[model samples]
Target chain A: MSLQRPNEKLKSDVLIGVGLRHQHFTEALTTPSNIDFVEVHSENFFAQGGATQSVLAQASEKYAISLHSTAMGLGSAQGVPSQYLQKLKQLASTCNPILMSDHACFSWSQLNGQQVHAGDLLPLAYSEQTLMVLAHNIDRVQQSLGRSLLVENLSAYIQYSHACMPETEFLVRLAELTGCKLLVDLNNIIVTANNINAAQPLDYAQQWLAEIPTTMVGEIHLAGFTEVKEGELIIDDHSQAVSSQGWQLYRSALERFGKIPTLVEWDNNLPSWHTLVAEADKARMIAEQVFGDNHSSKVTTAMTGLESEFIHE
Target chain B: MNNNDAKKHSLQAAFEQVAQQQQTLISAIFPSADSEVIDEFDPRGMAIYRNNLLATAQQALAISFPTVLTLIGEGLFNYASRELLISSPPKHGDWALWGDDFPSLLTNLAQLSDYPFVADIAQVDRLRQQSMRAKNSVIEQASLQLLATHDIDEIYIELTTSQFGLNSNYPVIEFWLSHQQRVVSDTAEELNQKFIQQSLDKLVQGDFSQKVLIYRPYYNAEIRELSASEYAWLTLIKQGVSIGKALDIMTNNNELEHDFDFAQWIGIALEQNLINHLKV
Candidate 1:
């Protein structure tokens, strides 16, 4: 299987991929076309030798594989675990992912001489001390992996009262300090905005787009979130179709960032492969409209096949 | 307070305050309307976190106890899970090790006490999960050949990789197997002493006592149920017993009922890769 390098340049138009789940492993291997990359959770493939690993290996040969992690726990007070880093290195050496990404939240905390599951991507107090800790963690991760890691912004439910800075500023400062890229998950920003009752969705998007270094935006994530009550949004629910608001945010993001690779995540209640492909087609249309033709040759080649058959005559 | 001391004091104060506000903070994390908090916005915000925590806890429990979840419907299982979470929340960040005490928890629940075998089902479910994720030492090919020469009767043997032990008075395995055939309709009240006695009678006469080795050699979890004769044989092998004495014990006890074939049983064990090594 061909492993895409972390530093490899992406095509101009957003290349769309789905979060590959075990249920869809067979479908992913057999079905082809229009998907620019395939992303899988790193922990799922931690098994030594299994059907899951075999399927991932097969898919990697055909498509660009991006390894997204949930266990890195970059913001942990105790710091990153060396064992996890070693396992990640082994996985990277085996899979050769395009970009390795983890959430900006901590999953572990010290308890009774053992680290216990915090059960949530916990929100951290944005202070100078936290900034330093986060920078050190990111630096260590990059140094250990021998490549720059992309830290995705988190979808928070509540804001810390003592937080001295906004999340956007924290992310920008983080990127500047570590020389790492940012993975702008548009759904998370919307969820954060709703939770805090802070800014309008478009205003938040515009501010983030203008402030963040566009060059450092390595990828984008588009997912569906369900609203359980007023002013509360659950990001990545995967229950319904992508909301119009999310698509609008994607369009605005495309106009601002200019055609980075995008991903459509359907983790729960995953529909048929064709259903996801259809969503990818929508993203392709948006990409074409925003970036135009003169982007990357690979994307152009992919587009030509998809456009003539799936999009236009 | 001095500058450094003041900073430390304030941080400590902040953390204490946050911890003291557990209800509010937990509500923010899990958000259930059923909480004692009176504020409308508190419940709304709290419900989001409540649902999130519940859903995540439920997912962890489901992964750890797939067979248990299969036996009980998702709704009842989820309802039972809430009680378990309240009693014992996850202490670690890894969800894989979350539901360790669920079987015991189920056994103690007053609501589920009627379903006497629910806990045993949970035990099997937990073992299945452990078998899938637990680490095991790999055995070499040469180790199998050396076993034949050793005096198996003189030594005690231990299962290197596959280790699933169960000791119960109730016929839990049989009940589990029966439930798989169809949905269980008997309520706790309906499950009388007479039925229990009848089942126990069947169990003793029909070779109810058994030992099984559960482990993951390649990828998936495997369960190999052992008969009384085979159990004795493996136990002798495990004790570092010489093959001759082990067979002698088996012969003296008349453990093997009619048509006893040692070669066939050994072949099955070899094919299953159960024999790890011989202890000299």
Candidate 2:
């Protein structure tokens, strides 16, 4: 039930990976040569008897893995859902993922007498009020999960008028008060800055990362977005390839945070397995360039036996 | 409650209210919701989140009931799914096993009156999803020799949680298989319409009975057709009845006019790897 088992060997340097989408599961079973790790949405594998679990068991044999979730509702008033946390803890124990994380926003709320899932990640106000809420829920989650979890900052569409504290201070305070680290999604920062007219988007992202030191970042996520509504709002749809601007900010983030575990999060319009591995390779190249010889071989000697047979292919 | 507890409660209450109402969430959080807002805070921004929430629920339904979508066509299927979202939002964050109520909801749709069989057929898809999610029992291999060794009255058979058999008045199996994408017919629409008519004709002729057995022997969903009496015997075994009691019930039941061969049914079940194991 203990959670702090970091893969120091793999975590020795920045490792690259992609979200394990269903389209890529079969090819992933082939255990391609380049993938450093594979991350699966925790909710998808909650059911123990489905094909998702069978496929994940085979994939975990050959590749390093992580567990990312969007249903934690870290800011909900209904307290922590023991059932959701129970299943998540089971999956984490079974897989022993390199890292476990969920969004920093609320997705559950109490409506009348029933607990309702908002069906999407809803933004939380970055004021003194929500800061305490998020911290308390994170403590409960970390206690039950038996690990220090990582929380990703959300991409907001509107700034809160009543939220007295800035978003950076809120994230910093959460990490300081509770033991959880930040998941630092680079693309979300870009999308939010452009939509909300924060100074220059990349500069805004760099400034935010500057506030949190390298030790506090657990992981980084890069996903795609498109500006719709006459270029007024940038939606994090995850359907397209990551934009050129996103890549630039990603490089800046790597320079700021040094070498943290990074992932390409293409959730919707998923590409073929080969194409996804290539995107992970692209993240690898950026990390290598930024860190400058602080990294090891691109394809490390982690797999043997059956993994060797397929990865070599 | 302490100040922190009270603050959290108010934040959650406000959030729950905004989810049900219009995107007044922005206005509640920031007065920018009312003004010609700044670049990042468009009033229409809430609509995008609204669409994403609806789309998430729709995609979940579409995944669970792909055949139903093909039967109703994508456009109308999208319409029906959205309507269901309006009528019933998800009550929890864990939606992996959601959409069990969808088949009943589909049957109540006024637009689907012409395709009354669609709802019943959709039930098969739900069964398949459930069967896939059912706990996989690690059963020792079942053998007729082992089963024969026990006195029929004294023996009990353990069935896996992943098996289901249903007998319906509609040609549910035919309707389901006809809509599956594997059939490779360019005129699938025309074929579906013809199959629908034939299914209805069979129903009117009082010969439209379809028997289906769904199970997840392996990790994947496996479905096959069964004979009428075979369905009855399997249902009895699934209910934990002793083999002797099951046979007696089958023999005593005068309600079923069409008879089935037990030996042939056992052979079918064994070949399909349907039974989990034998017990005494």
Candidate 3:
């Protein structure tokens, strides 16, 4: 199959795949339905010769791969590890992923002349200095990989006291300054809203959608979150089913932002392959509902070895 | 406040301050605290941090040490994990590489110390991980041809990069394999040492020290359980002994039969890509 361009607009019906776990690798690769793209965790494939690379190579021949990362630590004070970035770049070159993205959280804290693995993506303060640090990091990442990186907003539990602009503005400014696209995770927005006691997260989302340049939004993420107690909700929990409220918010996002590449992430308590496909089908249905049936036809065209020009305006 | 510097310093300071107070910080975000932060708009903010921290750490441990998690059910595993985290917090950004010390931590647990196999299982788990991420090397077919030049009784052989040596005092490998056959049923019951000793004796013939050759010619890492004699033969060969010298030692010790098919064994090793290069 011919390679597609990164800047090309994917069809509205396009449903991107999430990281494939060992449990679902066989089913995912052999499934009868045609998936538009397959995403993988960069760290999972760091091994030299393993089943992960073998399966990914096979899958790449059949589908477009998106190399998503969990350990880039792009926003850390110590900055990105050179070895990790080099390895990731090498993997990207070999796999030929369509896009690369990582969380906007810092996980590293320098201590005693060593960069230790903190095991978690800690929250960051939304300030100009932090923004500069992020921008420099993003620039380095993009330059090193020779590809524009997409930074996904993390779901945070705490907010800093430093007076600053809203997260939406911060992200928009970062994208504007660094020339990186946004991977708008609707679940994170919902989680942040619940954490902050925002009366209307949907409205906040709409405002964000309006403020951020639509062209800069490369992809969207939808995941389920559970309500721990009464009013608090955690996004991207990787457990439970995607709530209707989140789906509704997604629909609203589609209406405002138009068709964008979307992924359904069920990382933990992952169900069978059929369950994941069903979730993807749900996302596809929403896509069709907002963008019309012609969207799927275009998607089919792209799947059957057609050029991007055929589907794009 | 020159708009830029003020924003940068203030935000950095706030984050540093918040991260310092782990408990109160989580309570502030999560609002799951017994009481709410009345002054701030974000009440249950800390709860998010707490949940994320615990959940991420739990998930990392769960992935790294599946056998331990399985031995203890999810509830108890979570409890043990929480205790472990409080004592030894994660110090890095990579979650996958996190919990490198979890196996040792579990071994030190007074509750878990009775099961001597737990630590060995952890060792096996780490070995599996190392095998997965180990560097790639190509085995040479020419290396096997050297075996044909010398008489079976006179040659010393060597192993190459495609091989891995695992030395263990316990039947950790067998324990892991059996545990994989069934989900751990009860954590409250004490391990039966007599039954374990019998099984270990049958597997190792009362030999506590054994050498296993782990090599991956293709995709999966294959473990070949070697006898003490075979291990010695392989070790000498791996140390660059000429094929003739290695075979002489094996034959002198009666470790090899007169009719022992050296060619067939060499062929199998070649097919498995265990041979990399020849010294002679």
Candidate 4:
């Protein structure tokens, strides 16, 4: 059977947002609703009761909320632990998020019978065995939430030789089995492609894109990556602005995906709010250039912040 | 186990090998502890996972126990936290509760002996964090009525889950009180200078013994010194003692030893919301 696809939710235009950051909490609340939605990590609001929940409520008030998670180890061999799942479910019900997403990697594993949290997303082997486990876990999460989830790919530094299938193929099979959506993170694809020396990386990206049905991809993630001192590995640290190679790849993704909801995620070395808003505007402008013919009038109406009355000086 | 169980067990076993033991996963793409690099991938690739684990543990400890970090300097703190990371990795995905046993790290390190109270401060840090984030129980209507109707000998009293007490040989409460600013933003060197300028040694100089009472003060943990009878009564109640025996010791009405103002004591307990309420 073919991969199940959800109906398009947002208007085909207005395709970009910046992840809501506590550093930019003041600005996020005050800044005009230029972006479509603000994504917050679901685990941050797991407290019994605290100010962080109120901050999230305020952010939700201004823009649509996307509960992006980092800790739910969906690819775990044992399974997603029930406690983390319960917390995420509560957050989902509370926020009524527009979209929820997490990495297609394991961050928790069972040592004997005890569940241990890795706290960072660990890559999985791209084999059918691994795929089966991941598919089962993803289905569990989606069923429990009563909503579809968009699982992103891992920017793995190492690959497993036993991974008989390619990463793209694994994801395609996972989506077909679980009815899950994909949040294709371009920078991760770029980072992994470069690190793997995939001959022609862009063609490889296009090749992977070709293998997966575009309808299954619900969102796009653009983030900055840093290369280590030895230059052998490009770490997806999400520290800086999106690189030129990353931006070019985004254009390719936009050309193929056709203006899906995109997010600019900068977690470390956080820039000022103005700088982040500019990055969101850049993504919007790029998408406008790609889909300008059908979406020009909508783009004019979406003029916000610097793109509007403030600066053209 | 079935085939699915076998495959799942194997996956978890391999994941634990890397995550818990810091050993490389035995994948051809990763080095097998020995430097056998694959054809295209670099051997250093596995270092990324190791580095990610380190950064994650380090950052979690940084937020949960900022007081420890501030007291011991960043370099030493990071070093100690890394050691603690390997020894006691996170049990749950909640980073807020990740460093639950970090105080033991401070108490065990020999280099930190000069500041014996630092471990207590770490505990204070944890309790403060828990108190601030967790909603405290309100005074239970049933509990108050039950307490009012029943004589001290007729009922058993218990402290709320939010109340904690530490009887330390050192004046830890004063030391903890001196450093309880909610946020620990100062560098260790700066904090050390402040510690010296305030002659903080005096806090620990007295009989060098004290009892510290910890309970929810509004949303955060409030650290205060306990009176002789308050401390005795709480200890007895905490041990599940019947109120009669505790009262005998508290007021010496049965000539047990001493005397306390029972009416004033109950009023204070009611005001502080320290008495446990019925669970249902």
Candidate 5:
């Protein structure tokens, strides 16, 4: 079955949003901001009741909610847990999120006959078998949610020897098979390239982005990476500001894919709400520069239902 | 081989290889059986992922067991969390659901032998965390009419799903309350020592046992101390016992200093949202 997009209207504008961390929840709900939407880690709000749901409800009242999960582990051979899907469905029903997404890595595997979560995104080999697993899980999730899922590419630290295809080709095929869209995380591409010692990581990422069909791409994610000592890996820790290289890569993305709803994801060493918003504003300015004035002006229509409800409340 | 059969064999081989590789990589991350699981991948990259898993597990435990962290200090807490993560990695993707084994780990630690109250406090933290995540309850006031209309022997009082009870030998409820502020910075050793001394002093002077009731009456979980008789009464009610039978158990027990007052206890339980409803 073909998965339907969560919102058709979202495709019209160059919308920019920020990952809504808990520190900025009060300000995000209480104050008006320039952002078009707010993306939250779906697992963070998984609790059945109490403050999490209440906070999510208040946040939904103010802005469009994007449910980005880290642990769906769509590439896992063991399959997504039924309880996890149930909780996610309940959360989606509660907020009616504008977008739902998860990483394209496997975090669930069996150890000693017991299924366990690695607690971090573990890289998957680019093979037909892995692709099939991802497609099956994605189809199941889409069927459960009755919408398309946006699968983000992982910044894999290690490479498998027996991979059958390039990451881009694998992702494209995944989208084709499952009718799911891809959440192209630009920084993850650069991080992966740089870790493998690509001569020009930025150019490599642009080349990577060139492979995916533009229509299959749903959203863009811009994040900063942590630079370790020389000879050490540059981790996708999302701690600092987006690098000069990252922006250039993002520019290439906008040039190639046109304006897509983008998110500024700074998950660690979190800055103030103002700083986070400034990062989103920077993304918006870049998108404006790429798509010109009319596209940025169209972003005002992104939060369709919440704006009036927010004002009335 | 035929074309379709050849494709099927190739796909099966690929699936087996991928599954085997993931199992090796995950086992290496937690380092249980094989130390040389990094032969296929870059050792440096594998180490980074391994460290990430430990940090993730540690951070999750810190959030759920803030009181334990504050009481034990950051150094010890991190070490314990890392050890637990290595021994039994998170089975649940959500960290909140993964740390139920943590209090038991605290109980089993040899280093914490001197601080006997630590395990009980950890249990309290776990219960509070569980209570917070418990489904929202609407106390069924309409069902209370069953208590008045039906014979006491036929009536059963149901407690909210969020309610839990813990009976500890040490005065853990007091210790848990005293260490509510979660220390983000490295907890000073001297502070832990001082707290330990105070806890030991309180342990010597305070009652030998404390019955703690943790329940989310509204949005937040509240910890309330229960008398022995009250704890016994609630334990009976929670066991699907009829209200008359529970009262009989409390009344027949000679350990109590005073008589069990069903009316007074019901009033308090209703007020505190401990009772979901009285059913017949």
Candidate 6:
């Protein structure tokens, strides 16, 4: 397979992509399409061999691929494993994704004096100490990749009482320190808000979006959440269609972030390929509406901010 | 202290605090005999994370060992997976690399004592997964010329690393492949059931000892059964024995069929990608 360089250009116009799942590989590869890019879990293709690797190569040719990893453990005090980063570097060198991201969480830690991967994205405290660790690890990753990385806010089940700052402030500070950008998942904001029993989750999420500088967010993620009954936690399961509230948050995010590269991620109980693409189409149409109505102030400021050398190519 | 020194001191303090808390949480999740339960975390939140971890482990293992899950069902699989997770918890983040010890876990579990063949089936599944995830390598077709130019004693046959040999007393390939068939149609499901029944019958008859070869010539891993002679011959070839020495060893073995033909075996091995290259 050819190790061609991925398209690094971040479009100033509205761009939408779908998560290219293994089940939808044939349809995505064979069909005539208008989707701008495809995002895949980086760990799934780390093997770099077999049919999985072949399908990823085919997807890379068809669309601008995003390498979103789940296990980079960017906030772990133990730091990212050299072996894991080496494998990721090999995959990145081959696939050459346009964007790579992981959560502001830690999955690697020592248990009973033995290093272990928790196999789940464990939440990190939003403190100066954690920020230093996150920045140190992100710097290590960026230095290894010879490119910038994106750190995403997680939908955490538990919030640390000792956290010194808001999640948005923490992420913005992370970008400032590491020269990385943010993948602001709108669904995660809403899910986290609802889980924390925020009286108005949509309003909370909108405020959360307003805190980050427009240029710091390079990409936006729109996904669905599974809401439980009273006395249960709302899950960022990505099982259903993007909620109407999620769309509203997307609109709010667009009004602020202004036409960033967005992805519609439906991981569980996956819809058909056509149905999945429709979600991306919805995101594009919504972006057009958001930018069409408020083109002067939001668009211009976001454009001016993004045009600064840090966020733009 | 200087500004940079102060920042470094704070960072070290933070690392220690975060590391201590994380280790505490991890110990709670994968508790050992020496584990001390820290009461600082909320019980409800801890339960959510614990459930999520176990669920993730189950899903990951199910992908690697689908036949084992199918045979034992989810309830038992969850129990055994949880047991395995606490004992041999994934050293790395990749779940695919985490379950190499699952077959041994199955063999040692008292709950699965009645189904000993399940362990062997799991062994085959692990090898199949390894074969699928192994680095893709190309056969040195140029080295085939060595077989023709050199004498039998002077030439060594090399097999691809993707090839694995599993010798099971149970009918593993038959039992495993019967489940691998995609029963898309009702008729296919019936045929699969029939094949599974036949295999079970052979399994009960107690002479179904088989040697299984999982070979990956290209992308997908394929499982095939080998006769005693072919397996013995391949085993010798894998031990870096010369073609003549392997043949001589196979011929002298009373347990193996003396009718082992290197000419036919070479043709079959090359076609199946069992032979990587011929070395002199």
Q: Best candidate per lDDT, number?
A: 6
Pitting candidate 1 against candidate 5, the one with the higher TM-score is: 5
- On the 0 to 100 scale, the lDDT of residue B58 in model 2 is 75
**TM-score for each of the candidates:** 0.78, 0.86, 0.78, 0.80, 0.89, 0.90
After superposition, candidate 6 runs with Cα above 4 Å error? A1-12, A293-313, B1-10, B31-39, B181-208, B252-255
- Model 1 TM-score? 0.78
lDDT (C-alpha, whole model) for all candidates: 0.68, 0.74, 0.67, 0.72, 0.82, 0.83
- DockQ of predictions, in order shown: 0.23, 0.35, 0.32, 0.33, 0.65, 0.70
Question: Mind giving the per-residue lDDT tens digits that candidate 6 earns over B49-109?
Answer: 8888888899999999999998899999999888887788887878888899999999999
Ranking of candidates on DockQ, top first: 6, 5, 2, 4, 3, 1
Off by over 4 Å in 2: A1-12, A227-231, A299-313, B1-42, B142-149, B182-201, B257-263
> What's model 4's TM-score?
0.80
For model 2, what is the alpha-carbon lDDT of residue B280?
Answer: 77
Stronger candidate by DockQ (1 vs 3): 3
- Give the distance in Å from residue B4's predicted Cα in candidate 4 to where it truly belongs: 12
What's the C-alpha lDDT at position A136 in model 5? Answer: 76
The reply for model 3, stretches above 4 Å from the true place, is: A1-19, A111-114, A292-295, A298-313, B1-48, B68-94, B99-109, B112-117, B135-138, B146-163, B183-197, B200-207, B217-224, B236-268, B271-273, B276-280
Question: What is the lDDT ranking, best to worst?
Answer: 6, 5, 2, 4, 1, 3
Superposed by TM-score, candidate 4 places the C-alpha of residue B144 at a distance from the truth, in angstroms, of 7.0
Q: By DockQ thresholds, what CAPRI class is model 2?
A: acceptable
Per-residue accuracy of model 1 over A213-273 as CA lDDT, tens digit each: 7677888888877766664445556655566667777877887777677888888778887
lDDT of 3 by residue, A95-153 (tens): 88887898787665543234444555556678766676677788899999988988898
Indicate the DockQ of the complex predicted as candidate 6.
0.70
Clashing pairs in 5: none
Off by over 4 Å in 5: A1-12, A294-313, B1-13, B33-38, B181-202, B205-207
Q: For candidate 5, write residues A36-85 as lDDT tens digits.
A: 78999999989887788889999877777899999998888778999999
